[model samples]
Target: MPTLESFFAPQDNIALENEAAEQEAHLIAEVEETFMKLIEIREAKFMDMMDAREKKYRALLN
Candidate 1:
């Protein structure tokens, strides 16, 4: 029986390299999307707090 190394020895290494590169690119894109969503959520919360503060100050002034 042929060993695992012998079986893979004749295969094109470039295909494996390309597959790894594609997976890495996909992972990076997912991470970037997640980061951007988190930033947007933070910004929304900050805006909400600012609006609340403005409402409170206006009520106090009135």
Candidate 2:
């Protein structure tokens, strides 16, 4: 014999909210990692270009 309160229990979205939060956290982590990789690649490219320029200048000087 169920009570009227049980029949009219509130339907909360706690579970859905938690699931969405978890997904958002995962996406943020992935985006951060990708951004770090992009920064590393940019640095590497800049270093390579500087090295090439230095070699050209040294050749011109000699």
Candidate 3:
């Protein structure tokens, strides 16, 4: 049977490296997607608050 350390040899090492890189890319993409969604939600909420504030100020002026 092969030792555990044997897996770290050239061929197997390359495979692990590729898998790790692929996973990293996938995680990065997921994070970016979630961040963009959060940004959109934050902007929408800010706009809503600004609109409400404008209405309140207008009411006070009347």
Candidate 4:
């Protein structure tokens, strides 16, 4: 039982678009943070392995 004017209001579209944009921004931020943390963990593991290999090689040399 709603009128056409109420259904097709201009402000409604703007509000919906703004809400979608905010949600997208929030999701992007979360994904970026997760990726950074993953990268840091990978780097730390790689460094640890490299150190272990170097120590083993030095022990063999000596």
For all candidates, the clash counts are 0, 0, 0, 0
Error (Å) of candidate 1 at residue 1 is: 21
The models' CA-based lDDT, in order, is 0.89, 0.87, 0.95, 0.94
Give the winner by lDDT: 2 or 3.
3
- Candidate 4 — worst ten consecutive residues by lDDT sum? 4-13
Residue ranges of candidate 1 with Cα displaced over 4 Å? 1-11
Q: How well does candidate 2 score on lDDT at residue 53?
A: 100
TM-score of every prediction relative to native: 0.80, 0.80, 0.85, 0.86
**In model 4, what lDDT does residue 17 have?**
80
Better of 2 and 3 by TM-score: 3
Off by over 4 Å in 4: 1-8
Model 3 has an lDDT value of: 0.95
How well is each residue in 1-62 modelled by candidate 3, as lDDT tens digits? 99886858888888888999999999999999999999999999999999999999999999
Best by lDDT: 3
Per-residue lDDT for 38 in model 3?
Answer: 100
User: Model 3 Cα displacement at 14 (Å)?
Assistant: 0.7
Using lDDT as the measure, what is the rank order of every candidate, best first?
3, 4, 1, 2
* Tens-digit lDDT track of model 1 for 1-62: 87655556445566776888999999999999999999999999999999999999999999
TM-score of 2: 0.80
Q: For residue 7, give model 2's deviation from the true position in Å.
A: 14
The regions of model 3 sitting more than 4 angstroms off are 1-5
